[model samples]
Target: MFQLVSTIVIRRLLVAIPTLLLLSLVVFVVLRLLPVDPLAMMLPPSATAADSAALRQQMGMDKPIPVQFLIWLWDAARGSLGNSINFRQPVVGLMVTALPATIELAVVGLVLALMISIPGGVIAYVLYKRKRETAADLVVTLLQSIPSFLWSLLLILVFGVLWPVVPFSGRVGQEVTLPGITGFAMIDLLVTGQFQAWLSALSHLFLPALALALSFAPLVIRVLRSGLIDAANEPYVEVARLRGLSETRILWRHMLKNAALPTITMIGVQFGFLFGGALLVEMIFGFPGLGNLMVQAVRGNDLPLIQGISLIFCVLMLAITVVVDVLYALLNPKLRNL
Candidate 1:
């Protein structure tokens, strides 16, 4: 079992290298293809022709396109990812600081999703089979269809403006001093004994997290429902029932276990999407994260930052898919020897 798992993990890591390289290439090419010149975009409005030319030369924009790519690629290989002309910080440094916050937010959001989605789907299936649909199904369906941004907007209005229960526009409440631990303010503060900052950060994160889960919940429910329905009809389920297993036990233990594979896949996919989607939520709530950072980079036409971040996202997606694949193999016996 250990060998099997190790083999799978190493294969995934090997596959990830090329996937990341391809991602870097696509991002580099696409950004270079953009009409705006990064050097010109970064210059002041009052700059003269000489200033523009000097800025272009300083940014290596004057180099041949192929030559410029080598420079950027070399920096990326060295873990610098170049400096952001807009932020005036090393791209890698900025991401190293912001990435953890985004990952934490994604984790929090996915946790909320699973907490609500799994049981919601199971309960809904149980109720649906009995021909007595509950209000939970209706509510869950409704919540899932609404856009994430709309929910974020509503959260800002309710929690930030009207109720004042949470501060909407920053990493922490203004009064609380943040200690930069792991770059995830909520976790860092809690670990460092800054309970006030921790609570403040958590308070602000709640509505957005809830909104994200709600937005993605329906699809998870749908996937699980289909999996459950299929599992219930399997010959194994019938055999279990014939053995005098309780229907409730069969439903929860037997059928649901078999049904979880697809649910896990969908959940993983949503999480990959969440890495990009959460930026809007982060921006609306004034959270400093990769998504917010990407938005800033895009607006400033900071090509290096944009390319680096885009590659990160592509790599993130590849990693999630690999995780889901391994999980699927683990949960399904047919996948083991294959």
Candidate 2:
């Protein structure tokens, strides 16, 4: 089992290297080709041509495109993702501060999504068996049709404004000063015994996470429902029924175990979309995540920061894909042989 898992990890990493290289190259080339100059935003309006030239030289932007890319790549290989022209900080540093926040948000959102989706799927399957699937279908349709940003708005108005149940903006309240241990607020707060701050963080996190959950859960519900329906018709399920297993046991222990394979795969696949959706949701809630950083980078034409964030996102997606493949192999032992 260990060997199989190791082999899969090795194989996936081997494939990921070239994929990341190609993606980085594409992102580098495309960003350079844009007509807008990074220095335009970096320099003052009264700056001279000489000032522009000197600044370009200082930043190594005066070099040829290929040379610039090579230099950037070299710098990136050494873990220095170059400096953000706008923020005037190391891109890696900026990402370090922001990425964890985004990750925490994404993870919480995914958890909430699964929490809602899995039961909803099981219920929908039970309803399908009773010929009452239309209600489930209606609910799923309504949830999926609305975009995440709109959900964010509605959540804000209902929970943040109308009832004032939860804090809508920011990761923590102003009075809560958390030590930056893991960059994850909740984790850091808990570890440091700041229970009050942790509660504040969770309160702020709920609405944005729910908005993400609302957007992502519907698809998982549909996929799991379909998987359950298919698994129910399998010959093994029939045999289990004949063996005098209760319908509930057959559904939970047998059917759900089989159905979960596809549902897990779907969850992994949808995670990329969830990450993207979190960006918009993050912006709506004033969450200081990568999405907000990316927006700032774009507005200021911070080439290095933009490129770094783009590459990081690509890497994250690839990592998620690799994780999904490993999980798939674990669930279905047949793939280990392949």
Candidate 3:
């Protein structure tokens, strides 16, 4: 098992390295090709020619694009992601501040999605077996039809405007200040024994997280229901039935385990979408996260910040893919042979 796991890890790393390199090159080139002038955006209108030249030289924008990319790549390799022109801070520092919030939000959203989707999937599968799948199918379609941003807007209108049950915008209420130990508001608040602040954070988190969950849960339900239905038709299911196993036992003991494999894989794939969706949701909810940072970078034409954030996102996606592959292999031993 150790050897197999080692092989999988090595193989995934081999693929990921080249993929990351290619993606970095592409991002660098694309950002350079954009028509907006970073220097113009950053400099004051009263700045003279010498000022422009000096700033350009300082940022290495005076160099050829290829040379600029090489220098940036070298600096990145040496753990310097360059300064954000907009924020006027180190890109690394900005990411450190923003990434944890994004992670916290995404994780909460994913957990909520799983909480909703797993039971939904089982119920849908049961309905499928009973040939009464209309209601389940309708719910899936309704959820899937609306994009996450629309869900965010609707959630805000209903939960934020109409009922006003929870705090709809921000990570925590301004009055609830906790020391940033882990950078995660909820964890930091809890660690400081700020139970009231923690509750405020949870309240602020719910709408955006629910938007993400609603957007993500439909696909999970569909995938899991399909996997269960397929598992139900397998020969082992027949044997379990022949052995006088109750339908519930056969499903819980036999079908769920196998069906979960594909569901897990689907969840892994959907996590990327969840991150993408979180960007918009964060924007709508005024949540400070990488998505919000990226948007600011773009608006201000902060190429360095954009490149850093894009590379981080690419790396995260690759890491998630590797983890999913490893999990898939662990759960299905037959993959070890490959």
Candidate 4:
């Protein structure tokens, strides 16, 4: 097992090197090719020629595009991604400050997705099992077909505009003031014993998380339900039944265990969607996160910030891929043995 894990880790790292290189090259080329210059955008239009020269030199933009990318790549390797043009802070510092919010949102969204998916999947499978074409199944199918952003709009319309049950946008209420502990508002509030602030933050979080959950749950439900149906028809399930195992035990312990692999794979794949979905959702609802930061950076032509965020996102996706591979091996021990 240890040897297999080591091999997988090494192989994944090897694969990630080329993937990151290609990503960096693409992002650098694309950003440089844009008509706007970061320095020009940052400086006033009335600035003289010497000022422009000095700014370009300072930003290393006076160099050839290839050389500039090389320098940026070198700096990135050293964990210094330069500074953000818009925020006037180190790219690393900006990412550190903003990443916690995005992470918190994504984690909450994933939890909500799982909570909705697991039960819905079992119920769907049961309906399919009994051959009952119910309204619940129709609802699930409709939800599966709709895009996440549409759900965001629907959530905003229903919960924000009409009923006003949850806060429309933002990560916390203005009235709830608390010191930043871990950068996550809810955690910071809870650690400081500010229950009201925590509740406020949670309420603010619900709408976006719900949007993400609604978007992801249908996929899980479909995948898990198919797995369950297939696993149920296997001869081992009948053998387990003949061996006096309860139906519930056979379903959950035996069937669900085997059925979980595809769902787990789907969850791994959906991590990217969660982050990508959060980008639009954050933009829609005015949530201050990495997504918001990226939008601002793009508008301001902040190359450093854009490159740093893109690189970080690419690394994160690669990391998720590695994690999924490991989980796949662990769950299907046959691969590990091989």
Candidate 5:
């Protein structure tokens, strides 16, 4: 099993290298092709043509496209991603600081999404078998039809503006400052025994996390429901039903377990969507995550920052895919042979 896992990891890494390289090239080309000039970001509006040319030359933007790409790639290989033209900080430093926040948000949001989606989907399927066209089904359909960002806006208006149940934007209250251990607010707060800070952090996290969860929950539910329905009709489930097993026992032990494989796979696949949604969600709530940093980089035409972030995202996706594949293999032993 260890050998198998190692072989899988090696093979996946081999594929991931080229995939990331292609992604790097695409990001590099797209940023260069954008009409916005990075020089405009660096210089004053009154700066003359000569000044612009000189600045471009000094920054090595005057190099040929292929030459520029080769130099950037070489620097990247050496763990030097250059500096953020806008923030004037090391691109790697910016990513390191921002990555944890984004990861924390995404993990929390996924937890929230799974917490609701799994049970909701399972119960819905169980109930639907007894009665078709139930209210739960309709609710799922309605939620799926509405755009996530629109729901985010509505949530902000209702919860943030009207009732004021939770903090509207940002990670924590301005007055509350906890140690940045692990750069995860909840973790840091708990580790320091700062319950008040923890509560405040939860309050700030609730809305954005809820919004992100609601956005992805419908898809998760749909996938789970379909998988549950199919699994319930399998031969093993039929055998269990005939062997004097209770309906609940058969459903939970046999059907749900088998059904869960697909749902888990779907969760991994939907990670990209979750990450993409985080970009808008972070911007709307003023959360200082990688997505927000990415948005700022784009507006400033920060090539190194953009390339770094994009490459990071591509690497993350590839790593996730490998984990999901391994999980699928473990859950369904038939896949182990492959």
Candidate 6:
């Protein structure tokens, strides 16, 4: 088992390195091909020609595109993620400040989505069990198909505008306040043992999390429900039942274990979706996160920062997918044994 796990890990690492290289190279070239210049965007129109040229030189605009990318890539390798043109802060430091909020948002949203999806899938599978004529199934399908951004907007309209139950967007309550922890506002507050600060953060994060949950939940429900339905009807399940296993035991302990693999695979893809979806939601609600940062960087054509962020995102995605693939192998014996 150890050897197998090690081999898989090594394979994933090998794959990951090349993937990162190619992804970063593509992203770097694409950013350069754009018409905008970093200096033009950073400085106001009233700036003198000399000032712009000087700023360009300072930003390494004088260097060839290939030369600039190679330099930046080297710096990135050395753990220097470069400073942001717009924010005037080290990219690493900024992520340290911003990542916590984003992590919290993604974590909470994922948790909620799992909660909604797993149970929903079971309910949907059981209710529809070979009888595909239920309003509930239709509702889940329709809801899942709808885009996450649209749901967030609708959430803002309903909860933010009409009901006022949940705040529209943002990671913390304006009135509650917090000392910047650099990376994680919520954790910083908790680490400092400030319950009130945690409360403020919670209120701010709740709606966005819900929006994410609503978006991801349907897929979970659909996949898990189908898996459960199939597992429940399998010959092994029947044999287990005949062997005097309790129905609940057979369904949960045995069936759920097998069915979980598909759900886990879905989660891997959904994790990627969470990052992608966060961009739109962050923009919609003014949430200060890496997604929001990326948007600002892109608009200014901040290549260094954009490259840095994109590279991080690519690594994150690769890591998540690798983990998921390994998990898929581990959970299914037929896969791991090979």
In model 6, the worst 10-residue window by lDDT is 125-134
Per-residue lDDT for 1-338 in model 1, tens only? Answer: 55666777789889888877777777787788888877765778899999989888887888787788888878878877888889888888888888887887788888898888788788878877464676766777778768878988887788778887766776667798777767777778889998876888887677777767778777888788889988988999999989999999999888998999989977887787677669888888777889999999989999888888887887778778777878888888887865
Once model 1 is optimally superposed onto the true structure by TM-score, how far is the C-alpha of residue 185 displaced, in angstroms? 2.5
Tens digits of per-residue lDDT, candidate 2, 1-338, equal 67777887899899989988898889888998998889887789999999999999999988898899989989999999899989889999999999999999999999999999989999998899465677779889999999999999999999888999899999999999979998999999999999999999999999999999999999999999899999989999999999999999999998888888998888887898988998889899999999999999988988899999999998898888878878888888577566
* Candidate 1 whole-model C-alpha lDDT, 0 to 1: 0.81
**TM-score of each candidate structure, all chains considered together:** 0.91, 0.97, 0.96, 0.93, 0.94, 0.91
Per-residue lDDT over 1-338 for candidate 5, one digit per residue giving the tens place of the 0 to 100 score: 66667777889999998998888888888888888787688888799999999999988899987788889899999998889999989999999888888888888889999898988888788776576647788889888776656767888999989988889788889989859778888898999999998999889888888888898999898888899889877898889888999988988788887888988888898898888888888899998899999999988878889889998999889988999877877788676666
Q: Write the per-residue lDDT of candidate 3 for residues 187-300, one digit (tens) a residue.
A: 898888999989999999888998999999999999999999999889999999999999999998889889989998989887999999999999999999999999999899
Every model's Cα RMSD, please? 2.3, 1.3, 1.6, 1.9, 1.7, 2.3
Q: Model 4 over residues 1-338: C-alpha lDDT tens digits?
A: 87787888999999999999999999999999998868876679799999999998988898998999899889988989999898889999999888888888888999999999998888888788465747767888899887778898999999899988889778889897757778998888888888988999999999888888898899899899999999999999999999999988898889988899988998998889899988888888888889989999998999999999999899888888888888888998679679
Q: Output the TM-score of candidate 5.
A: 0.94
In TM-score terms, which candidate is top?
Answer: 2
Off by over 4 Å in 5: 132-134, 336-338
State the displacement of the C-alpha of residue 177, model 5, in Å, after optimal TM-score superposition: 2.1
- Candidate 4 residue runs with Cα over 4 Å from true position: 129-131, 134-137, 336-338
Report the CA-based lDDT of candidate 6 relative to the real structure: 0.82
Error of 1 at 161 (Å): 4.3
lDDT of 5: 0.86
Among all windows of 10 consecutive residues in model 2, the one with the lowest summed lDDT is: 129-138
Q: How far is candidate 6 from the true structure (C-alpha RMSD, Å)?
A: 2.3
